[model samples]
Target: MEITDLTPAERRVWEAFPRGDGVDFREHPEDSSVDGAGWGPERTVRAEVLRALLLGAGRAEEGRVAGLKIKGARIVGSLDLRYAVVDHAIRLRDCWFERKPLMYGAQLKALVLGYSTLPGLTAATVRVDVVLRLSCCRITGPVRLQGAKLSALFLQGAVIGPTAGEESDEPPLQLNHVEVGTDIIANDLTVHGQLRLNGATVGGQVSLDRARLLAPGGIALHAETLTVGTDLRAHRMEAHGMVNLTGSRIPGQLNFAYAVFVNPDGVALRASSCAIGEMWLRNCPPVQGLVNLRRSQFDLLHVPAATWPEKIRIDGLSYRTLAPHLPAQERLPALEREESGYLPYAYEQLAGAYRTAGDEAAARTVQLAKLRRHRRTLPRHGRAWGLLQDVTVGYGFRPLRAAGWLLALLLVGSVAYGLHAPRPLKAGEAPDFNAVFYTIDLMLPIIGFGQESAYAPAGWYQWLSYLLIVTGWVLATTTAAGVSRSLQRQ
Candidate 1:
């Protein structure tokens, strides 16, 4: 087939493709206005001509290392290359497209549409040998790349969303089940709809640093079961809706430092059952809604103090270590915010972490707080028993309180027995009527010091002896129980 009848603009690109050279049609950068509004046909290139050049249509005389690189052209018509095998790299910079570039199931070296304006993209299942970049491009519709394989996918500083008054039922950026070799760097990406990354697997990192997801009161970023070999950094990213990462496995760190997730009506972050290594939720504002970390496991969890939101679901959430190594007092408040009601496992998990850190005192504090929270849901009699245990034994967390109770009881008995004298049963035969010894004998159950047997208390003093005996038995039982618990914990 003879390659003739090419327009002056098309001829320039055709001539440059053989030498892997590029053709620039614009007088200045972005010389073609957005959407190619008011652009003349002189700077236009048909998609068919560009596609023909990319498919090895160039003459054999002009030859080696051929690629297609064009800039600042108004591309008319759909650039469809579905299922075609193109062996050249195609890069169109600062260009305007009349329609979405279609590359579904196509095999290519690279497809870079940097700083271009297009409706959207449909490159699902396409395999790109090198990077597939749409950096700083303004896309007006959804971009789907489900099950695609790429070395890298860079959408840095891109604005991908629907046009004004366009209904956003579908996600604007879809990378479902994508297998990327290196990374998906989308820093400073602005999307007006959800960014779906369901089941995507990345070999390296996935950075959404400073990205703005503006889907308010909806699912902003849904990445369920996403597997990242390394870190998933979303530092300072802003999401006006929920960021759901349920069941995702990020072996490397999931760093969300300074990121703001706002979804007041529902869950702000639903990261249930995720297997994460070191999650940093540091130095951010209070999450607007419930943060669901249910059944999730983390190697390390880093959070700032007093920034916990009012609602949380942390049942079955386990972490090995906490950064900043805060005491139980600082971290216990987060457990209290569980919206689904108090879970003893949450407290136990916290207490165990403190114990692992060799902070027995902090562990006891956490256990004490757990008892208090548990006591609220008890029956009337159960609550009364709990109150007695708390006041006298500090729920086994404060064993010193039990000693204090014993001292107070002993003081009361001593004062009562000192003021009153009990007549001796045997005249001049019994030991001397020592008030302290007799009081000790009366209060201590099953331990006779011979003073009680020698003396006979008449009138109200006898009744006081009985009262002291009962009080002593109760105190001894409670103290024994509390001490047994303390020993077991040790």
Candidate 2:
């Protein structure tokens, strides 16, 4: 691509290219009056000029393009570099584009479009060896990076949405299936539409710190099935709609501390089936919607006990450790804070988690709380019976409770039998009427001491013996069940 092959606008841009020693486009000029100072006089360049530059860079004798700098210029027409391979950086600072640059399937070293305003950007299937920086830029239309492979993507302080008075139906940013070798930093970004990163893979961290996303009545950030090699840090992030991270696999920590989510009638954070390292939701603002963590697994969970949403779903969540430790009295109530309050397994799962963490006392407290809540769910008339069963046998959690009840019943039966002694049923029946022995014989339904058959209870003592027999059977069955559960947990 020679100067003769360039269009009139391209020819002017080529003529204006700063030629001479010590001219670097990679570094911003210090002098404000310079041509490439980034805030200097605006220059209009045709898309053909950019294509010729890339071609010239590819065919350079040294195999390196020194600098391709264009500042404060309005790039006319769509700059299509699809499949064009270049080995140098392209820097466009404080420039405006009439249309989005199409870089689909292009291979480049690096791209810097900082402080620029563009209609949109399309880099699907494009591969960059280094960073792609769009910091402080304003995009009017969607910014698509689907299937792109880059080292890092920096959009810090960028504004992605429809321009004023323009209506957009598409998402603000789409990174679906994109793979980044390093990080994706979008700190302080303001996105008006959904920011979709579904199926994306990041080798390093995905930091959206202090980002503000607004897509009311819809999803604000959808990163389902995303795989992040390192931490996914979203501290102080403010999202107006649902932020779905379902099925994501994060090998490092997921920190969302001090984040604010506001989807009143829908899910605020849906991380179902996700496998994350440490999870931090501590000090976050009260979420208006549900935080679904069903089937998710994490090493540690740090969440505010009282600030959780009323409709949290933690059916199969398994966290090895929890932070901000509260006493059992406080922890048990926190587990029952869910609206509808019918999740028995949720309590069991928490208890199991506590037991796994070597907190048996806390686990037992959780189990007791579960039994109390379960009793409350019974019918009004059946509540008393359920409470009795729970207190006497811990609803099959405390086998010792059955033993205590059995001893009390045995003592009462013995005292009654002693007061009114049994009489012999037959002549010279060996008077097998020791009060303690008679009581024991009645209590043990299967193995009798031969006293119950040899003697008969007088007056109301017979009814007392019948009560003791029924109580013994109930206690025995409950004790067996409780022991089985304890063994299984161990």
Candidate 3:
């Protein structure tokens, strides 16, 4: 089929085609020459109106329909022409009207609708692999790309919807940003990507599900400065390179569920200055990359672990969603690689996680490891002395220390009484309370042996010293109680 300029008879044929659904015009070879005289006036008008209806219906023929002007055709309808082959890149620039255009469920080679002025456009299930550039176009609807596949899609600098209005210049119900691409850049655009919105304003969900970015140096999808009113979901998106989102403000959740980021040099989600509602990065295992959220703000859930190996330096943050599933040993590499100052902090969280999981032995082991690391920096004597005290006096452990202190005080008092004060009646001998009383007489020796004066010299002096020691102990115990309570609560 060859496409020639529209003649008066050809125009009549186009007009004769039904304007309703399930109607299509046959494909003919498109004349590359830009000759308007061939189609004339009457034929041009008929072709223009018919072309609008066909494109709107997704019923446009594959071959070519060139040299025919079809601008500002207000055909309120939906399009669904899938697997249509176009030899040349199609152009639909600056075409306006009220309707939901369905380009989804279609397979095109190349599209060039750049600088096109459109209002209320919706395309879902569309598949284009070559190049689809709609740069700087004004669209007033949810330009949805639900389940679409594009090689290089460039909607750069395009205005998705109007400001100060909820009703999109087009219509609502935009599907998610579901595309597999070599280079897909939709930066600085103001409109939600995931859903068909009511207004042209940027407010809805954005999903980049199962999308693969094949680029190496930079990211596959670049959506910076996107002011979302709802969630920005990127589930199962595999990027072979860095995914840089320098500055984006989201009013709702920023979800990266099960996303694989393969950037070792750079980060996966570098949202340095974003203001998110709730950030969810669930089930994202440790990657050899950074997800730096430096200076970013999140309202609710903050799963810092889910965003692991990501250099997320949050200055002013409200992170209530911090749940660690992995133990401290597993997260050390990530902490070191990211050079996070919160390494110890993350370790503390891991300890808590183990405790919460009812793994007391594991928790104790982790804590002991931390203590050993801290002890390694101390002097040898101090470390040895501390370790000795840890076993003997139980160090800071209250339950064992309490019993140990009681027994130590008893032994000291008993020995002091025997050596310093010998009983006169016994004649060169002193009643050994420790042996006679044994365990049953433990309390009597501890509290009373030093309380009374003995016949041996230095009796009053020893009694006074003992009283002072008891008083000193009471005061020390009180102070220790206060310190223990304070630390335990914190």
Where in model 1 is the C-alpha error above 4 Å? 1-3, 30-35, 59-63
RMSD of 3: 13.2
Tens-digit lDDT string for candidate 2 (269-309): 89999999999988997888988888899998888677688
Q: For all the candidates, what are their Cα RMSDs to the real structure? A: 1.8, 5.0, 13.2
Worst 10 residues of 1 by lDDT: 29-38
**Residue 196 lDDT in candidate 1:** 94
User: For candidate 3, what is the TM-score?
Assistant: 0.46
Can you write out model 3's per-residue Cα lDDT over 1-490, one digit (the tens) per residue?
A: 1124545544444443332112112122332112222333342233244344344422334453432223322222333344444333344444333344446467765665555555544446676667777666666555666556666666655656544435333322243345544444444443432222111224345555554444344554455555555666666666666665556777877776677777787765567676777777677666556667665656554454445664654433334334444555654444444343433444454455566667655555455445455565679997885565444433333344545555665566556555554344445464443421332133333444522322333466346445546543643453355347436734
For candidate 1, write residues 346-432 as lDDT tens digits.
Answer: 998888888888888998999889888999999999888888888878877777887787677678767877887889999999998
Q: Relative to the unseen true structure, what is the Cα RMSD of model 1?
A: 1.8
Q: Candidate 2 clash total?
A: 0
How accurate locally is residue 89 in candidate 1, as Cα lDDT from 0 to 100? 88
Ordered by TM-score, highest first, the candidates read: 1, 2, 3
Q: Considering lDDT, where higher is better, how would the candidates rank from best to worst?
A: 1, 2, 3
- Among these predicted structures, which one has the highest TM-score? 1
